[model samples]
Target: MAQTATRHAKLWFAGQAENWALAAYEIDELHEGMEDAGKYHPTHKQIKQAIPELIAQYVDQPLTALEQAINAKNKAEFIANYDKLTAGCNACHQATEFGFNVVQRPSFNPFANQAF
Candidate 1:
Protein backbone atom coordinates (compact mmCIF):
# COMPACT_ATOMS: atom_id res chain seq x y z
CA MET A 1 0.00 0.00 0.00
CA ALA A 2 2.77 2.43 0.80
CA GLN A 3 4.56 1.69 -2.44
CA THR A 4 1.34 1.98 -4.34
CA ALA A 5 0.73 5.34 -2.81
CA THR A 6 4.23 6.33 -3.80
CA ARG A 7 3.61 5.34 -7.40
CA HIS A 8 0.43 7.34 -7.38
CA ALA A 9 2.24 10.36 -6.05
CA LYS A 10 4.97 10.00 -8.63
CA LEU A 11 2.46 9.73 -11.42
CA TRP A 12 0.70 12.81 -10.11
CA PHE A 13 3.85 14.93 -10.39
CA ALA A 14 4.72 13.58 -13.83
CA GLY A 15 1.24 14.29 -15.08
CA GLN A 16 1.29 17.70 -13.51
CA ALA A 17 4.63 18.50 -15.13
CA GLU A 18 3.39 17.35 -18.49
CA ASN A 19 0.30 19.43 -17.97
CA TRP A 20 2.29 22.59 -17.33
CA ALA A 21 4.81 21.98 -20.09
CA LEU A 22 2.05 21.36 -22.55
CA ALA A 23 0.14 24.41 -21.46
CA ALA A 24 3.18 26.67 -21.52
CA TYR A 25 4.28 25.47 -24.94
CA GLU A 26 0.73 25.18 -26.30
CA ILE A 27 1.65 21.79 -27.70
CA ASP A 28 -1.25 19.51 -28.50
CA GLU A 29 0.74 16.27 -28.41
CA LEU A 30 2.21 16.98 -24.98
CA HIS A 31 -1.21 18.11 -23.94
CA GLU A 32 -2.51 14.77 -25.12
CA GLY A 33 0.07 13.04 -22.95
CA MET A 34 -0.98 15.14 -20.02
CA GLU A 35 -4.59 14.26 -20.72
CA ASP A 36 -3.69 10.62 -20.73
CA ALA A 37 -1.86 11.02 -17.45
CA GLY A 38 -4.93 12.66 -15.98
CA LYS A 39 -7.08 9.75 -17.04
CA TYR A 40 -4.66 7.07 -15.92
CA HIS A 41 -2.94 8.70 -12.97
CA PRO A 42 -2.81 6.48 -9.90
CA THR A 43 -3.63 9.16 -7.39
CA HIS A 44 -6.63 10.75 -9.06
CA LYS A 45 -8.94 9.85 -6.20
CA GLN A 46 -6.66 10.94 -3.35
CA ILE A 47 -5.82 14.06 -5.32
CA LYS A 48 -9.46 15.03 -5.64
CA GLN A 49 -10.44 13.79 -2.22
CA ALA A 50 -7.55 14.69 0.04
CA ILE A 51 -4.06 15.55 -1.22
CA PRO A 52 -4.94 18.52 -3.42
CA GLU A 53 -7.56 20.12 -1.21
CA LEU A 54 -5.25 19.72 1.74
CA ILE A 55 -2.39 21.40 -0.07
CA ALA A 56 -4.63 24.16 -1.31
CA GLN A 57 -5.46 24.73 2.32
CA TYR A 58 -1.95 24.46 3.77
CA VAL A 59 0.65 25.09 1.08
CA ASP A 60 1.17 27.79 -1.53
CA GLN A 61 0.87 25.32 -4.33
CA PRO A 62 -0.68 22.18 -5.95
CA LEU A 63 0.36 22.47 -9.63
CA THR A 64 -1.94 25.42 -10.30
CA ALA A 65 1.22 27.48 -10.23
CA LEU A 66 2.09 26.15 -13.64
CA GLU A 67 -1.23 27.19 -15.07
CA GLN A 68 -0.84 30.65 -13.63
CA ALA A 69 2.73 30.95 -14.83
CA ILE A 70 1.79 29.94 -18.34
CA ASN A 71 -1.13 32.33 -18.35
CA ALA A 72 1.24 35.08 -17.33
CA LYS A 73 3.30 34.38 -20.46
CA ASN A 74 6.35 33.52 -18.43
CA LYS A 75 7.65 30.42 -20.05
CA ALA A 76 10.99 30.78 -18.32
CA GLU A 77 9.27 31.22 -15.00
CA PHE A 78 7.09 28.24 -15.80
CA ILE A 79 10.11 26.06 -16.47
CA ALA A 80 11.90 27.17 -13.33
CA ASN A 81 9.00 26.72 -10.98
CA TYR A 82 7.99 23.56 -12.76
CA ASP A 83 11.22 21.96 -11.51
CA LYS A 84 10.12 22.51 -7.95
CA LEU A 85 6.68 21.06 -8.51
CA THR A 86 8.17 18.03 -10.19
CA ALA A 87 10.58 17.65 -7.31
CA GLY A 88 7.75 17.67 -4.86
CA CYS A 89 6.23 14.76 -6.72
CA ASN A 90 9.47 12.84 -6.46
CA ALA A 91 9.79 13.74 -2.83
CA CYS A 92 6.44 12.24 -2.05
CA HIS A 93 7.40 9.12 -3.90
CA GLN A 94 10.69 8.80 -2.03
CA ALA A 95 9.06 9.47 1.28
CA THR A 96 6.86 6.54 0.60
CA GLU A 97 9.95 4.47 -0.22
CA PHE A 98 9.10 4.11 -3.87
CA GLY A 99 12.14 5.71 -5.41
CA PHE A 100 12.21 3.48 -8.44
CA ASN A 101 10.32 5.91 -10.63
CA VAL A 102 11.86 9.19 -11.59
CA VAL A 103 9.96 11.82 -13.51
CA GLN A 104 11.74 13.69 -16.28
CA ARG A 105 11.29 16.72 -18.48
CA PRO A 106 9.53 16.41 -21.78
CA SER A 107 12.01 16.07 -24.62
CA PHE A 108 9.83 16.22 -27.73
CA ASN A 109 7.20 18.75 -28.57
CA PRO A 110 4.17 17.08 -30.09
CA PHE A 111 1.86 19.98 -30.69
CA ALA A 112 0.59 19.45 -34.21
CA ASN A 113 -1.31 22.64 -34.81
CA GLN A 114 0.47 25.55 -33.13
CA ALA A 115 4.01 26.54 -32.24
CA PHE A 116 5.11 27.92 -28.95
Candidate 2:
Protein backbone atom coordinates (compact mmCIF):
# COMPACT_ATOMS: atom_id res chain seq x y z
CA MET A 1 0.00 0.00 0.00
CA ALA A 2 2.83 2.34 0.70
CA GLN A 3 4.25 1.76 -2.75
CA THR A 4 0.83 2.23 -4.24
CA ALA A 5 0.52 5.53 -2.43
CA THR A 6 3.86 6.66 -3.76
CA ARG A 7 2.95 5.62 -7.27
CA HIS A 8 -0.37 7.37 -6.94
CA ALA A 9 1.32 10.63 -6.04
CA LYS A 10 3.92 10.18 -8.74
CA LEU A 11 1.22 9.51 -11.29
CA TRP A 12 -0.51 12.74 -10.38
CA PHE A 13 2.67 14.74 -10.70
CA ALA A 14 3.60 13.11 -13.96
CA GLY A 15 0.20 13.79 -15.44
CA GLN A 16 0.11 17.32 -14.13
CA ALA A 17 3.47 18.02 -15.69
CA GLU A 18 2.22 16.53 -18.95
CA ASN A 19 4.91 13.89 -18.77
CA TRP A 20 2.88 11.17 -20.44
CA ALA A 21 5.61 8.56 -20.46
CA LEU A 22 6.26 8.82 -16.75
CA ALA A 23 2.53 8.89 -16.06
CA ALA A 24 2.12 5.71 -18.06
CA TYR A 25 4.93 4.07 -16.13
CA GLU A 26 3.41 5.09 -12.83
CA ILE A 27 0.03 3.79 -13.93
CA ASP A 28 1.59 0.46 -14.77
CA GLU A 29 3.29 0.42 -11.39
CA LEU A 30 -0.01 1.18 -9.73
CA HIS A 31 -1.64 -1.71 -11.56
CA GLU A 32 1.14 -4.04 -10.52
CA GLY A 33 0.81 -2.90 -6.93
CA MET A 34 -2.90 -3.64 -7.04
CA GLU A 35 -2.20 -7.08 -8.44
CA ASP A 36 0.35 -7.75 -5.73
CA ALA A 37 -2.08 -6.61 -3.07
CA GLY A 38 -4.73 -8.99 -4.29
CA LYS A 39 -2.28 -11.81 -4.71
CA TYR A 40 -0.65 -11.42 -1.30
CA HIS A 41 -3.77 -10.51 0.65
CA PRO A 42 -6.72 -11.99 -1.11
CA THR A 43 -9.02 -11.42 1.82
CA HIS A 44 -9.15 -8.95 4.60
CA LYS A 45 -10.76 -10.00 7.85
CA GLN A 46 -12.79 -6.81 8.18
CA ILE A 47 -13.94 -6.76 4.58
CA LYS A 48 -16.56 -9.13 3.32
CA GLN A 49 -15.42 -8.95 -0.30
CA ALA A 50 -12.13 -10.25 -1.55
CA ILE A 51 -9.43 -7.63 -2.14
CA PRO A 52 -9.31 -8.45 -5.83
CA GLU A 53 -13.04 -8.09 -6.11
CA LEU A 54 -12.93 -4.69 -4.47
CA ILE A 55 -10.16 -3.66 -6.85
CA ALA A 56 -12.10 -4.86 -9.85
CA GLN A 57 -15.27 -3.14 -8.70
CA TYR A 58 -13.63 0.18 -7.98
CA VAL A 59 -10.20 0.68 -9.54
CA ASP A 60 -10.26 -1.14 -12.83
CA GLN A 61 -12.59 1.12 -14.79
CA PRO A 62 -10.83 4.28 -13.77
CA LEU A 63 -7.52 2.73 -14.62
CA THR A 64 -8.77 1.89 -18.08
CA ALA A 65 -10.05 5.41 -18.50
CA LEU A 66 -6.72 6.76 -17.29
CA GLU A 67 -4.95 4.69 -19.89
CA GLN A 68 -7.17 6.07 -22.60
CA ALA A 69 -6.58 9.59 -21.40
CA ILE A 70 -2.87 9.04 -21.46
CA ASN A 71 -3.05 7.64 -24.94
CA ALA A 72 -4.99 10.63 -26.15
CA LYS A 73 -2.81 13.06 -24.22
CA ASN A 74 -5.91 14.76 -22.97
CA LYS A 75 -5.25 16.78 -19.87
CA ALA A 76 -8.91 17.38 -19.05
CA GLU A 77 -9.79 13.73 -19.29
CA PHE A 78 -6.70 12.75 -17.38
CA ILE A 79 -7.54 15.04 -14.45
CA ALA A 80 -11.16 13.94 -14.38
CA ASN A 81 -10.31 10.28 -14.48
CA TYR A 82 -7.53 10.74 -11.96
CA ASP A 83 -10.10 12.02 -9.51
CA LYS A 84 -12.24 9.01 -10.29
CA LEU A 85 -9.29 6.75 -9.57
CA THR A 86 -8.68 8.55 -6.30
CA ALA A 87 -12.34 8.14 -5.43
CA GLY A 88 -12.11 4.46 -6.19
CA CYS A 89 -9.19 4.19 -3.84
CA ASN A 90 -11.16 5.93 -1.13
CA ALA A 91 -14.17 3.76 -1.75
CA CYS A 92 -12.13 0.63 -1.31
CA HIS A 93 -10.53 2.04 1.78
CA GLN A 94 -13.95 2.82 3.20
CA ALA A 95 -15.19 -0.65 2.37
CA THR A 96 -12.20 -2.12 4.18
CA GLU A 97 -12.78 0.12 7.21
CA PHE A 98 -9.76 2.18 6.33
CA GLY A 99 -11.68 5.27 5.39
CA PHE A 100 -9.36 7.39 7.45
CA ASN A 101 -6.62 6.62 4.99
CA VAL A 102 -8.16 8.91 2.42
CA VAL A 103 -6.00 9.70 -0.57
CA GLN A 104 -5.85 13.09 -2.23
CA ARG A 105 -3.82 14.69 -4.99
CA PRO A 106 -0.28 15.37 -3.95
CA SER A 107 -0.02 18.84 -2.47
CA PHE A 108 3.72 18.84 -3.01
CA ASN A 109 6.24 16.51 -4.53
CA PRO A 110 8.45 14.72 -2.02
CA PHE A 111 10.50 12.81 -4.60
CA ALA A 112 13.02 15.55 -5.15
CA ASN A 113 15.48 13.16 -6.71
CA GLN A 114 13.13 12.30 -9.56
CA ALA A 115 12.05 14.88 -12.10
CA PHE A 116 8.56 14.43 -13.38
Candidate 3:
Protein backbone atom coordinates (compact mmCIF):
# COMPACT_ATOMS: atom_id res chain seq x y z
CA MET A 1 0.00 0.00 0.00
CA ALA A 2 2.79 2.40 0.82
CA GLN A 3 4.46 1.64 -2.50
CA THR A 4 1.19 2.19 -4.29
CA ALA A 5 0.81 5.56 -2.60
CA THR A 6 4.27 6.62 -3.65
CA ARG A 7 3.69 5.55 -7.22
CA HIS A 8 0.37 7.38 -7.20
CA ALA A 9 2.04 10.62 -6.17
CA LYS A 10 4.86 10.15 -8.65
CA LEU A 11 2.40 9.40 -11.40
CA TRP A 12 0.72 12.74 -10.73
CA PHE A 13 3.95 14.66 -10.92
CA ALA A 14 5.07 12.81 -14.05
CA GLY A 15 1.83 13.54 -15.84
CA GLN A 16 1.72 17.14 -14.65
CA ALA A 17 5.19 17.69 -16.02
CA GLU A 18 4.15 16.07 -19.33
CA ASN A 19 6.68 13.35 -18.83
CA TRP A 20 4.74 10.66 -20.63
CA ALA A 21 7.43 8.00 -20.41
CA LEU A 22 7.69 8.26 -16.64
CA ALA A 23 3.93 8.45 -16.28
CA ALA A 24 3.56 5.27 -18.32
CA TYR A 25 6.11 3.51 -16.19
CA GLU A 26 4.37 4.59 -13.00
CA ILE A 27 1.02 3.44 -14.34
CA ASP A 28 2.46 0.02 -15.12
CA GLU A 29 4.00 -0.16 -11.67
CA LEU A 30 0.72 0.78 -10.05
CA HIS A 31 -1.14 -1.88 -11.99
CA GLU A 32 1.38 -4.55 -11.09
CA GLY A 33 1.16 -3.60 -7.42
CA MET A 34 -2.61 -3.90 -7.49
CA GLU A 35 -2.38 -7.27 -9.19
CA ASP A 36 0.10 -8.50 -6.63
CA ALA A 37 -2.14 -7.33 -3.81
CA GLY A 38 -5.09 -9.16 -5.29
CA LYS A 39 -3.07 -12.33 -5.80
CA TYR A 40 -1.51 -12.37 -2.37
CA HIS A 41 -4.51 -11.27 -0.37
CA PRO A 42 -7.59 -12.38 -2.19
CA THR A 43 -9.71 -11.62 0.82
CA HIS A 44 -9.37 -9.61 3.96
CA LYS A 45 -10.95 -11.01 7.11
CA GLN A 46 -12.66 -7.68 7.79
CA ILE A 47 -13.75 -6.86 4.27
CA LYS A 48 -16.63 -8.84 2.80
CA GLN A 49 -15.66 -8.29 -0.81
CA ALA A 50 -12.76 -10.08 -2.43
CA ILE A 51 -9.71 -7.88 -2.97
CA PRO A 52 -9.54 -8.70 -6.69
CA GLU A 53 -13.21 -7.94 -7.15
CA LEU A 54 -12.91 -4.63 -5.40
CA ILE A 55 -9.90 -3.69 -7.51
CA ALA A 56 -11.63 -4.67 -10.72
CA GLN A 57 -14.65 -2.60 -9.83
CA TYR A 58 -12.85 0.49 -8.65
CA VAL A 59 -9.51 0.70 -10.42
CA ASP A 60 -9.50 -0.99 -13.80
CA GLN A 61 -11.62 1.36 -15.88
CA PRO A 62 -10.04 4.52 -14.59
CA LEU A 63 -6.64 3.00 -15.14
CA THR A 64 -7.54 2.23 -18.72
CA ALA A 65 -8.66 5.81 -19.22
CA LEU A 66 -5.46 7.05 -17.70
CA GLU A 67 -3.45 4.93 -20.09
CA GLN A 68 -5.36 6.34 -23.04
CA ALA A 69 -4.90 9.88 -21.78
CA ILE A 70 -1.19 9.32 -21.49
CA ASN A 71 -1.00 7.77 -24.93
CA ALA A 72 -2.68 10.81 -26.38
CA LYS A 73 -0.52 13.17 -24.35
CA ASN A 74 -3.66 14.98 -23.35
CA LYS A 75 -3.05 16.90 -20.14
CA ALA A 76 -6.65 17.83 -19.41
CA GLU A 77 -7.91 14.30 -19.93
CA PHE A 78 -5.02 12.94 -17.92
CA ILE A 79 -5.80 15.22 -14.96
CA ALA A 80 -9.50 14.38 -15.05
CA ASN A 81 -8.81 10.66 -15.19
CA TYR A 82 -6.16 10.99 -12.54
CA ASP A 83 -8.73 12.45 -10.15
CA LYS A 84 -11.09 9.65 -11.09
CA LEU A 85 -8.35 7.13 -10.27
CA THR A 86 -7.71 8.84 -6.93
CA ALA A 87 -11.42 8.73 -6.15
CA GLY A 88 -11.41 5.02 -6.96
CA CYS A 89 -8.56 4.47 -4.53
CA ASN A 90 -10.46 6.34 -1.83
CA ALA A 91 -13.61 4.43 -2.63
CA CYS A 92 -11.78 1.14 -2.26
CA HIS A 93 -10.36 2.28 1.05
CA GLN A 94 -13.85 3.24 2.18
CA ALA A 95 -15.19 -0.15 1.15
CA THR A 96 -12.51 -1.85 3.20
CA GLU A 97 -13.36 0.34 6.21
CA PHE A 98 -10.07 2.12 5.73
CA GLY A 99 -11.59 5.44 4.85
CA PHE A 100 -8.93 7.22 6.85
CA ASN A 101 -6.47 6.31 4.12
CA VAL A 102 -7.65 9.05 1.84
CA VAL A 103 -5.47 9.80 -1.21
CA GLN A 104 -5.28 13.09 -3.06
CA ARG A 105 -3.16 14.89 -5.63
CA PRO A 106 0.32 15.57 -4.39
CA SER A 107 0.66 19.15 -3.13
CA PHE A 108 4.44 18.84 -3.07
CA ASN A 109 6.94 16.52 -4.61
CA PRO A 110 8.57 14.25 -2.06
CA PHE A 111 10.85 12.47 -4.54
CA ALA A 112 13.46 15.17 -4.74
CA ASN A 113 16.09 12.68 -5.83
CA GLN A 114 14.18 11.74 -8.94
CA ALA A 115 13.27 14.38 -11.50
CA PHE A 116 9.70 14.20 -12.62
Candidate 4:
Protein backbone atom coordinates (compact mmCIF):
# COMPACT_ATOMS: atom_id res chain seq x y z
CA MET A 1 0.00 0.00 0.00
CA ALA A 2 2.76 2.40 0.91
CA GLN A 3 4.63 1.63 -2.26
CA THR A 4 1.54 2.14 -4.34
CA ALA A 5 0.74 5.36 -2.56
CA THR A 6 4.26 6.65 -3.16
CA ARG A 7 4.04 5.75 -6.81
CA HIS A 8 0.70 7.48 -7.03
CA ALA A 9 2.19 10.61 -5.56
CA LYS A 10 5.12 10.48 -7.92
CA LEU A 11 2.77 10.11 -10.85
CA TRP A 12 0.60 12.93 -9.65
CA PHE A 13 3.70 15.06 -9.44
CA ALA A 14 4.66 13.99 -12.91
CA GLY A 15 1.27 15.05 -14.19
CA GLN A 16 1.71 18.41 -12.54
CA ALA A 17 5.02 18.73 -14.28
CA GLU A 18 3.30 17.91 -17.59
CA ASN A 19 4.99 14.55 -17.92
CA TRP A 20 1.87 12.92 -19.28
CA ALA A 21 3.45 9.63 -20.29
CA LEU A 22 4.92 8.96 -16.87
CA ALA A 23 1.72 10.13 -15.24
CA ALA A 24 -0.29 7.73 -17.36
CA TYR A 25 2.00 4.81 -16.52
CA GLU A 26 1.86 5.56 -12.81
CA ILE A 27 -1.91 5.86 -12.90
CA ASP A 28 -2.18 2.40 -14.43
CA GLU A 29 0.18 1.03 -11.83
CA LEU A 30 -1.76 2.65 -9.03
CA HIS A 31 -4.98 1.08 -10.30
CA GLU A 32 -3.38 -2.34 -10.51
CA GLY A 33 -1.88 -1.98 -7.04
CA MET A 34 -5.25 -0.96 -5.65
CA GLU A 35 -6.97 -3.96 -7.17
CA ASP A 36 -4.24 -6.35 -6.08
CA ALA A 37 -4.15 -4.99 -2.56
CA GLY A 38 -7.88 -5.29 -2.19
CA LYS A 39 -7.95 -8.85 -3.50
CA TYR A 40 -4.81 -10.63 -2.29
CA HIS A 41 -3.17 -8.72 0.52
CA PRO A 42 -3.36 -10.21 4.00
CA THR A 43 -5.68 -7.50 5.14
CA HIS A 44 -7.73 -7.62 1.98
CA LYS A 45 -11.25 -8.20 3.21
CA GLN A 46 -10.66 -6.35 6.41
CA ILE A 47 -9.30 -3.36 4.60
CA LYS A 48 -12.15 -3.31 2.13
CA GLN A 49 -14.71 -3.61 4.89
CA ALA A 50 -13.03 -0.91 6.89
CA ILE A 51 -13.17 1.58 4.09
CA PRO A 52 -16.21 3.79 4.62
CA GLU A 53 -18.54 4.29 1.67
CA LEU A 54 -17.36 7.84 1.11
CA ILE A 55 -13.76 6.85 1.27
CA ALA A 56 -14.45 4.03 -1.10
CA GLN A 57 -15.95 6.53 -3.49
CA TYR A 58 -12.89 8.66 -3.05
CA VAL A 59 -10.82 5.73 -4.16
CA ASP A 60 -12.96 4.89 -7.15
CA GLN A 61 -13.98 8.34 -8.24
CA PRO A 62 -10.59 9.92 -8.69
CA LEU A 63 -9.29 6.85 -10.45
CA THR A 64 -12.01 7.17 -13.04
CA ALA A 65 -11.63 10.92 -13.26
CA LEU A 66 -7.88 10.67 -13.61
CA GLU A 67 -8.21 8.11 -16.36
CA GLN A 68 -10.61 10.33 -18.25
CA ALA A 69 -8.34 13.31 -17.85
CA ILE A 70 -5.42 11.31 -19.12
CA ASN A 71 -7.36 9.88 -22.04
CA ALA A 72 -8.46 13.33 -23.08
CA LYS A 73 -4.99 14.75 -22.51
CA ASN A 74 -6.49 17.39 -20.25
CA LYS A 75 -3.65 18.69 -18.16
CA ALA A 76 -5.68 21.17 -16.13
CA GLU A 77 -8.30 18.66 -15.16
CA PHE A 78 -5.64 16.08 -14.48
CA ILE A 79 -3.80 18.33 -12.09
CA ALA A 80 -6.98 19.34 -10.30
CA ASN A 81 -8.16 15.80 -9.85
CA TYR A 82 -4.69 14.67 -9.07
CA ASP A 83 -4.80 16.90 -6.02
CA LYS A 84 -8.15 15.43 -5.18
CA LEU A 85 -6.69 11.96 -5.50
CA THR A 86 -3.82 12.87 -3.22
CA ALA A 87 -6.24 14.32 -0.73
CA GLY A 88 -8.31 11.17 -0.90
CA CYS A 89 -5.22 9.08 -0.16
CA ASN A 90 -4.29 11.19 2.82
CA ALA A 91 -7.85 11.20 4.03
CA CYS A 92 -7.96 7.43 3.91
CA HIS A 93 -4.66 7.20 5.73
CA GLN A 94 -5.96 9.50 8.43
CA ALA A 95 -9.21 7.58 8.67
CA THR A 96 -7.24 4.37 9.02
CA GLU A 97 -5.16 5.88 11.83
CA PHE A 98 -2.11 6.19 9.65
CA GLY A 99 -2.19 9.96 9.82
CA PHE A 100 1.53 10.00 10.37
CA ASN A 101 1.88 8.67 6.87
CA VAL A 102 0.40 11.75 5.28
CA VAL A 103 0.98 12.09 1.55
CA GLN A 104 1.60 15.42 -0.11
CA ARG A 105 2.42 16.89 -3.49
CA PRO A 106 5.97 15.72 -3.95
CA SER A 107 8.57 18.45 -4.39
CA PHE A 108 11.20 16.07 -5.72
CA ASN A 109 11.31 12.60 -7.12
CA PRO A 110 12.86 10.04 -4.83
CA PHE A 111 13.80 8.17 -7.97
CA ALA A 112 16.19 10.83 -9.20
CA ASN A 113 17.68 8.67 -11.93
CA GLN A 114 14.31 8.03 -13.52
CA ALA A 115 13.30 10.68 -16.04
CA PHE A 116 9.63 11.38 -15.98
Using Cα atoms with residue i matched to residue i, what is each candidate's TM-score against the true structure? 0.45, 0.96, 0.97, 0.80
Give lDDT for model 3: 0.96
lDDT of 3 by residue, 1-116 (tens): 99999999999999999999999999999999999999999998799999999999999999999999999999999999999999999999999999998999999998989987
lDDT of 2 by residue, 23-106 (tens): 999999999889889999999777889999999999999999999999899999999999999999999999889999999999
Which scores higher on TM-score, 2 or 3? Answer: 3
lDDT (tens digit, per residue) of candidate 1 on 39-107: 555354334333433333322353566557666756566666567655755665454455676665544
**Candidate order by TM-score, highest to lowest?**
3, 2, 4, 1
Clashing pairs in 3: none
| Deviation of model 1 at 98, angstroms | 1.4
Clashing residue pairs in candidate 2, if any? none
Q: Which ten residues in a row have the lowest lDDT in candidate 3?
A: 107-116
Error (Å) of candidate 4 at residue 22 is 2.4
Q: State each candidate's clash count.
A: 1, 0, 0, 0
Clashing pairs in 1: 28-111
- lDDT against the true structure, per candidate, is 0.47, 0.94, 0.96, 0.75
Backbone clashes counted, model 3: 0
Which regions of candidate 1 fall more than 4 Å away from where they truly are? 1-62, 109-116
